[model samples]
Target: MNATPCIIKLSHISFAYPGSDVDVLNNLDLTLCQGEKIGLIAPNGSGKTTLFHTIMGLSQPRQGTIELLGKPMRTPKDFEAIRTQIGLLFQDADDQLFCPTVLDDVAFGPLNLGFSKEEAKNTALETIHELGLSGIRDSVTHRLSGGQKRLVALAAVLAMRPKALLLDEPTAGLDMDVKETLINILNSLDISMMIISHEFDFIHEVTHKIYSMENGKILTDEEVHVHQHEHVHRHGRHPHKH
Candidate 1:
C-alpha cells in the first residue's frame, strides 16, 4: 500500500507555559493522515489540550517543529489561512460562542475569511440546518441549553468546511441522548478527526484509532475494535472506565 500524505506533522515538539517548571508536552512526535479518525485519551492535565493548542496554532512550541499541510507553521496568520481548513470545538461551549445570535456567531468564520454577508449567512444557515438547529438560528446564543450550545458551536466550525476537526471533550457533561446525537453527527461527517474525550465508549463508537497520552507524552497508538465499547486504559479511572 502507498504511504498516505500527512495533513499534520509534529516532530520532537516541546512546550512549557510561562512560570511553569514542567513541560506540558515533551519531545512529542505525531503525524495524522488525510482522513483518519483518532481518539486522544488522557487524564486531566495530561497535556491533551496543550497538544491541541499547539496543533491549532493558539500557542507556539518552545522547541521543535509543526507542519500543517506540508508547510512549516509559524505565526497566527499562517494558521489563519489554515484555520478555514481546520475546525476546533473547544471544550467550553461558552468560550467558543461570542456573538449575540446563533447566526452571527456561526457566520463569524466565513465572514472573517472575506465571504459576503449573504454568503456567510447562507453557509451558516446550511450548517445549522444540517445540525438540526434551524429553529435556533435567530435565537440568542447565551439562551440555548448546554447541549444546544454545543451543537451551535459545532455548527460554527462546520460552516467553515474544514478538512480536519478537533473536538475537545465533546461528550463531557452531556446527557446520553445528546451524546448519541453528537456521536451520530461525528460519524456522519467525512473529514479527518482528532477527538479528546474521557468517554471511552463514545470514542469507540466514532473513531477507528486511539492515541493515548500520559505525563506529557503519547503512550500508544492502536486500532479500535469495532465491537468493543470499553477500553483498557492505563490512565486512571473515570466514570466510564470501570
Candidate 2:
C-alpha cells in the first residue's frame, strides 16, 4: 500500500504578537502524519491557541515555515484552501456560532464556500440530525446549555466535511455523559485530528500521541502511554532506560 503523506508540518517556527517581544513559539518543530490523533497539552497563555491560529492561517510567524498538506502557507487565501480541508472547533462555542438559530449557524460555512442555498440547507439539516440536534434546529443558540452548544458547533464544522479537525478544549465544560459522546464522535471520525486541552483524562481517552508545552516551548513529544499501565515493574524493580 502507498504511504499516507504528512498533513501538517511546522519547521523552526518563531512567532510573537506585534509590539510584544515574547515569542509564543520559539523555533518550534512539529509534524502530524495522516490518521494520527495527537493531543497538545499546555497551560494557559503558553501559546497553544497561538499555535492553532498559526496553523489555521489566522496569524503568521515572524520567522520559519508552516506547510499544510504539502502546500506552503503564507497568505489568507492559501490558508483558506487548506482550511476547507481542516475544521477547527474553537475553545468557545459562542465564538463560532453567530447565527440566530442552530440551522442557520450550521449552514454558515457551506454557504460561504459557495454551496447552493438548497445544498447548504440539506447539509446543515443532515449534520444536525446526525448530531442529535434536530429537535433544536430552530432554537436560539444562546439559550442552549454549554454542552448542547458545543455539539451544535461540532455539527456546523462537520457539515463542511473537513478532512482534518483541530479542536481546542473540546470537553471543557461538558459533563461525563456528554463528554463521552464527544469522545465517541472523535473516535469514529476518519479525519486526522490535533486536540488542544488541559484535561489529561479527556486527552488520553481520545488521542494516541502526546505533546507537552510550557512557556511557549514544547517540553515533551512522544507516543502517549497510559499512566495506569505504564508504571508496572518489569522485574523486582522499575526498569530504567537512558
Candidate 3:
C-alpha cells in the first residue's frame, strides 16, 4: 500500500457567491495524497473551477476547513503562506504569461519570493531546461505558439517548486504532439496534482484516479472509464450514439 501522507484536505466545504441564492459547492470533501495524480471531470457549470478557487483561497467558503501540507488554512494570511506550497495553472496560458520574455516570466515567482536576481535567473533557466524549453528562453511570450506558451506558463509555476499543483484544463487547446509532450512532462514530475479537464483520454493518460462532479458534489464511485456505444430507442427502433 502507498503510505504517502495527505498534501491537501478539504472537509465539509460549502461555498456560495455573495448575494447569490445558490451554493456552487456544498459540503464538498476531497483529499489529495502526496505524489498522487487525481483528475476531476464534469460538464460546464458543475463547480469544478469554483472548487479550485476555493482551494487556492481566491474564493472563500461559507463553512468547513482546508488543510495544506498538514497546516490548517483559515485567514488570508494562512492562504498567503499556503500559496507558496501550491501552484495553480490557469486554463488559459495567456492569463499567466505577461513578462516580455519567457525567462523573465518564469523568473517572476522566484524574484517575488526574495531570491537574488542571479539566483532567480538560474532557477528559471534550470526550470526551462527541465521542461525542454531552453530553446525559447529569450523568446517573446506573445509570439510563441499555443504549445510553447502553455509549456512556458507551466515552467513559471514549476520554478516555484510547489509541492502540489492544481491544473485547470491543461490540455484544452493543444495538438497531438503538444498533448503528448505535456503528458510526458507531467509523468516525469514527482508532485501531487488535482487536474480538471473534459478530455477523458488525456486525464486517463496522466492521472491515477478519477472523480466526477455533479451539482457541486463529487460522486462516490471514483472508478471511471471512458466508453462509447450506440443506444437504441423504442421510437421506431431508432439508434443514436452519444
Clashes of each: 0, 0, 0
Estimated TM-score per prediction? 0.90, 0.88, 0.92
Model 2 gets an lDDT of 0.88
Q: Can you write out model 1's per-residue Cα lDDT over 141-242, one digit (the tens) per residue?
A: 999999999999999999999889989999889999999899889999998999999878998889988888866777655433323344576675756534
The lDDT of model 1 is 0.88
Clashing pairs in 3: none
Better of 1 and 3 by lDDT: 3
Looking at model 3, residue 8 earns an lDDT score of 91
Q: Evaluated with TM-score, which candidate comes out highest? A: 3
Candidate 3, poorest ten consecutive residues by summed lDDT: 220-229
lDDT by residue (1-242, candidate 2, tens digit) is 97778888998888999999999999888888899989988778889988988888888898888899989988788987789788999999999998999999999999988999999999999999988789999999999999999999999999999878999999998999999989988887888999998888888889988887765666555533335334445664655763
In model 1, what are the clashing residue pairs, if there are any? none
Assess each prediction's global lDDT (C-alpha) against the native: 0.88, 0.88, 0.91
Predicted structure 1, TM vs. truth: 0.90
